[model samples]
Target chain A: MEPFIRLTAVAAPLLTPNINTDVLIRVEPMIKVPKGKLGPYCFEAWRYLPDRSENPDFILNKPAYRSAKILLAGLNFGCGSSREPAVWALADMGFRCIIAPGFGDIFFNNCFQSGMLPIVMPVETVEKLAKLAQSQGDLAPDFTVDLERQVIVTPSGEDIAFRIDALKRRALLDGLDDIGVTLAAKAKIDAFQANDLAQRPWIYRY
Target chain B: MAASTLFEKIWTSHVISDLGDGFALLHVDRHILHDLNAMKSLVELRERGYAVRNPELTIATPDHGVSTLPGRNIDTVPEGAALLRGYLEETRRAGIRSFDMNEDGQGIVHVIGPELGLTQPGTLFVCGDSHTCTHGGLGALGFGTGRSEVIHVLATQSIYQKKPKQMRINFNGTPGKGVTAKDLILYLIGQIGADGGNGHAVEYAGSAINAMSVEGRLTICNLSIEFGAKVGMIGPDDTAYDYLHGRRFSPAGANWDRAIAHWKTLPTDAGAKFDREIDVNVANVGPQITWGTSPQHVISVNDVVPDPATAGDAARRDAMNGALDYMGLTPGQPIAGTPIDWVFIGSCTNSRISDLREAGAIARGRKVKPGVSAWVVPGSQQVKQQAEAEGLHEVFKQAGFEWREPGCSMCLAANGELMPRGQRSVSTTNRNFEGRQGPGARTHLASPSMAAAAAIEGAITDVRKMMV
Candidate 1:
């Protein structure tokens, strides 16, 4: 996993509510496409037309937003399925941050593992950012998300505060492997298991 | 100590250490895997030089990637053959029990867990699929985890989780005639938008929930993820105990008596407080179905497509318009009588023996309408055997419905069984997201009997009309 510190890039605005994981990457490509190779298949349904040509109407397909690294979205973004490939697809496509009113719980957690930041902002605030991004098109000023400072620097030079779980923020900053950290507490886990076995014998017997 | 809710009690008991900031390292009692995710974790563990911490507590099956065709083999779905083979070999190498496609215990992970007694009250269960919450119907704390978390569990048998707030939804009255658990849950999802239960662990209570069969409770809990709750559970009672008695992995002899005593103390105590509460009168909710891309775009069968012009806000209106265009639906048109080309009567939500029986009752004397391809894929091999012995298969077969083997067929379309593009289907599956069944395959979610009725009429028909 890449360590996330600070990033400055163009932001694409897709204001549709309830953009589920299914929309991020369909099931066929999710199963068949290997990791790091999912960039071409991201949002396949909306990204491509019936004849396999790029859908010109999609926000990401527009020339102004083709190189965007940030997504400004509406409520309940990534709301369906626990498929982690959805996050992989977005990361593969060069997306490093997403600003939405809310997010599905599992998808929210999956983002940190892939070095992608999911920020929950007020609906009004997100809509305001999206409006600004849309109004400027290719000339839209690049937005900066700084993890250490825990703020998003908007195109208008205003700093918007955000909060992430302290442990998660640290993990992302350092690109720490979680399993190695947990395995360091082997003694504590073994002790807990030994004590628990006596109280719930049936759990082990099964 | 103060009184505790069912979720509180289960969560407290499973905690190994508090990592602070509302996060804790939890001891997982059971870990179930399927072909879709097991191989990834196993390969990662091998690469990292870590053995499975507790192979005895882990079990696997090939469900999502295998075909449901009669006498199906790993190669039946050629695209998924490598995954199925890798899953079996890895589980065998790790000394974990794995049920193959032809095995008696093999089925959808959620279905077989409860059927084989691997799920029990007061246990914390984790799986790779979101519908793992189905085990919570048996009074367990079940939730889905991602691939990295799967590897974490394999190596340490523990997961770090931020405790979720508690919410209880009470179904206070009896369901009306022909209204099933599927309808009750769908109605709730419609009431509370798709993300209403986000970040909360939900508990189902009151008279309606208490009166439901265990299978019905499973159906209700299976869709918790669809509504944005990772965990959904019910307090175990005599119904759950009766259902688990004498099953394969259930406690026996003296262990049964002790296990029951512990489980009896697991329900919420009087005066326990929840962060939020919602009460519903099940008597008023009719058969429900989705009309759009998301699960929350639902209404009773008697209602019509809502006009986007009348929506409360511009965002919602745009969403409604997009859904209408994709579904090829006209505003103000009745949801009922919408033409459907396929009827899928199986999924983790509604593919149990009871679900099959309900669909069989509707299909017994009616033939599927011409040009509509209908299929009844059982939840598990055991469910299939039980349905076959009860002659449900014959009824479906006689009614022109294909009675297929057990797997997660067409639910996620992982096994290559999918409805063609530009078609519509009435599916018993939980999700109705865009392209869920296939590209351009519009789906309307409903109960098994409702799906069966749609097959017979070649359109979306109210199941109540054919209940008798």
Candidate 2:
């Protein structure tokens, strides 16, 4: 995983709420491919026509947003299913930051594990950014996300401050996954287990 | 201190270390995994040189990627077979208990957890799949986690977490006749859009929930993920205890007494406070169904399809328009009698014996309408066997429905069973997202009985009208 301090990229707006993981990445029958190969299949159902042709109407198919590295999504983005492939697909597709009103809990955690930064801002701010992206028409301008400063800089120099967990910010900056985070408290865990064993032997019987 | 919410009582008790800023290193009582993500996660653990701290507390099963075709061998579904083989191999190497695809106890992780008595009251459980909230029906604090967290739980038997705000949703009054638990939940999601419960653990209380059977409670809890809740639970009562008294994995004798004593204390106290409270009166909630691409885009079976022109905002209007286009529905058209190509009555949400029985009763003397295909995929082998022994399968087969094996089939469309592109279906599954069943496959989420009634009518017909 790569540490994320700051990222500047064109923002693609998916203005729909509850864009679930199942849509972000189709539930794959063949999940055995290399991690990097998932980018092509991101949003497969919406990205492609029935005849296997690209759906040109999709935002990602537009010439300007084709290289987008930031996603300005609506409330409750990545809301259903716990597939980590959703994060893998987004990250593998070159998205570095996702700005939304909120996110599904598991998907938010998966983003950190995959080196993607998820920033939660007020819904009004996200709507403003989304409107700005729309006004750009075919040539969406790049936005800058600064994790250390907890702010998003719009094309017009408007700064949108976002709130993220301090611990999550540290994880993103350090590129530390949950394993690394949990293992940091290993000594405390062991001591708690010893105390639990002495006090509640029957609890572990099952 | 004032009385604590049921969520705080169970969650705070499991905290081994409190990290600053509302986060904690909480102990996990049981961890469950399934085929889709388990194989890769187990391999990662092995490569990290971290042995599973306690294999006894972990269990894996083949559910997501297996065929629901009767007498089907793993080779029948090649991709599914490969995934199952990987899970089998990895579980063996990791020394974790795995319920093989052919085993009687093997089923969807959520179904098997309760059937095998692994999901006891007041415990913390995590799974790789989002619907792990299904176990919260047992009064447990259960939620989904990511792959890294699953591996972390495997290595240390604990996962880093933050306590979620607690909310309570009370369904008062008796639900009208022919209204199932699925209808109640769908109605709730419709009332409060899909993300209504975001960032909160919800407790389902009131007379309505107390009157439900355990299977009914499970059905309600299974859809908690759809509402964006971290977890949804019903406090354990005699209904729960009676259901678990002599199950295959339940405690016996004096141990049972001790367990019951603790379980009795799992409910909210008289003065417990919740961050949010919602009261729903079920006096008029008809057999509910989704009419659009999202689960929250719901209406009663008798209500007409919503006109996008009535939407309060441009975004909502656009969403409704897109859904109408994808669903091939017209504005102001009645939702009833909307033609459907398939009927699916399975998934963790509604595949238990009681669900099957409801579907079976609806299909008992009626044949499926022409051009409509119906399938009943049981939640587990035990559900399948019980349905067969009770002649439910014979009834379904006689009514032009296929009685399939146990696994998540059309629910995800990941397995071979899928509704064709451009086809419309009435499903008992939790999700109705665009292309959820398959690319361009339109879905109407409903109860099992409703699915059965649709199969017989070849359209989204009202189950209440069909009840005899």
Candidate 3:
């Protein structure tokens, strides 16, 4: 996992609410495509036309947003399915941060696991940023997401505060392997299990 | 301790250590896996030189990627063969129990867990599939994990989780006849948007929930993820106890008595406070169905499609218009009587023996309408055997509905059993996302009986009309 500190890049605006994981990466490629090679399959339904050509109408396909690393979306982004590959697909497609009004709980957690940042702002705030990105097009100023400071520097040079779980922020900043950290407390876990077994033997008997 | 909700009790009992900032290292009591990511996680664990911490507590099956076609094998779906084979090999290598293809206990992970008594009250269950919340019907704390979390659980048998806020939704009245649990949940999602339950652990309560069968409760909990809640549960009662009394993995003899005593104490105490509360009176909700893409885009069968022009905001109007266009629906047209090309009567949400029987009751002496291709895929091999033993298969077969093997067939179409592009289907699945059945294939989410009625009429017909 790559450590996320600060990133400055163009932001693509896709303001549709309830953009689910199934739409991020469909089931077929999700099963067959291996990790890190899913860039082409990310958002296959909306990214491509009926004939498999790039859908120029899609914001990501537009020349100005082709190299975007930030995504601005609407409510309930990444809802449906616990597929982690949806985050992988977005990462593969070069997106490192997603800004939305809200997110599905599992998807929100999955983002932290993948070293990607999911920022929640007020719906009106996101819409305002999206409008700025859209109205400026090719000349849209690059936005900067500074994780250590917990703020998003908008194109207009305004700093917007955000919040993330402290432990999650620390994990992302250090790119720490969570399992290794948890395994360090094996003694504690073992002790808990031993005590629990005495209290509830039926749990272990099964 | 003052008062505690069932969620708090279960969560506190499973806590290994508090990592602070509302996070805790949770001890996973039961870890379930399926074909999609379990084998890959196990193989990765091996590559990392880690062994499964508690293989005895882990169970696996091949459901997500296997074909449901008759005479199916690992190779039945060519893309899924490698996954099925890897699952068998890895589980065997890791000393984990796996209910393989055609095995008596093999079926969808959520269905088989409770059916085989692997799910119990007061236990914390985790799985790689989101619908693992279905086990919450047994009064367990169940939620889905991502692939990395699966590997973490395999290595440590513990996971880091931030405790969620609690929300108790009370269904205060009895549902009208023909309005099933599926309709109740769909109505809840429709009333509150898709993200209504976001960031909360939901508890279903009140008279309506207490009166439902265990299978109906499972159906209600199975779609919790669809409504943006990762954890949903119902407190266990005599119905749950009776359902698990003699199952394969359930405790017997003295253990059963002790287990019941512990489970009896797992319900919420009087005066327990919740972060939020929602009261629903289900006395008038009809058999609900999705008219457009999202689960929130649902209405009673008697209602007409909503016009995007009435939407409060531009973005919402655009989304509604896009959904209507993809679904091939007119704004003012009735959702009922909309022609459908296919009917799929199975999925994790509604594929138990009871669900099959409901569909069978509607199909007993009727024929599927011409030009409609209908299929009934059971949730598990046990469900299939039980349905067959009860002659439900004959009822469906005689009505021109295919009686296929057990797997998640036509629900997300992972097994290559998808409806063709441009066709519309009435599915007993949890989702109606655009192209969920197939690319350009529209879906109307409904219950098994509703899907069966659509199969007979070749359109979205109100199940109540046939119920009378």
Tell me each candidate's i-RMS in Å: 0.9, 1.7, 0.9
lDDT of each: 0.92, 0.87, 0.92
lDDT of 1 at A147: 95
Task: Provide backbone clash counts, one per model.
Answer: 0, 0, 0
> Any runs in candidate 3 off by more than 4 Å, and if so which?
A135-137
Mind giving the per-residue lDDT tens digits that candidate 2 earns over B316-370?
A: 7888898899999999999998888999999999999999999999999899998
User: What is the per-residue lDDT of model 3 for residues B1-468, given as tens digits with 9 covering 90 to 100?
Assistant: 799999999999999999898899999999998989877899988888788999988999888888998998889888788888888888999999999999889999999999999999999999988888888988999999889999999999998999999999999898997889999999999988899989999999999999999999999999888889899999999999999999999989988998999999999999999999999999978899999999999999999999999988988999999999999899999899999999999889999999999999999999999999999999999999999999999999999999999998799888888989889999999999987898999999998899999999999999988896
Which structure among the candidates has the greatest DockQ?
A: 3
Once fitted onto the true fold, the runs of candidate 1 whose alpha carbons sit more than 4 angstroms away are A135-137
TM-scores for every candidate against the unseen true structure: 0.99, 0.97, 0.99
Show the colliding residue pairs in model 2: none
Best-first order by DockQ: 3, 1, 2
Going through the candidates in order, their DockQ values are 0.80, 0.65, 0.81
Better of 2 and 3 by DockQ: 3
Q: What is the lDDT of residue A91 in candidate 1?
A: 92
Tens digit of lDDT per residue, candidate 1, span B1-468?
Answer: 899999999999988889899999999999998998888889889999898999988999988878989978878888998888888889999998999889999999999999999999999999988888899899999999888888889999999899999999999899987789999999999999999999999999999999999999999999898889999999999999999999999999999999999999999999999999999999899999899999999999999998899988889899999999999999999999999999999989999999999999999989999999999999999999999999999999999999999899898898899988989999999998889998989999999989999999999998899976
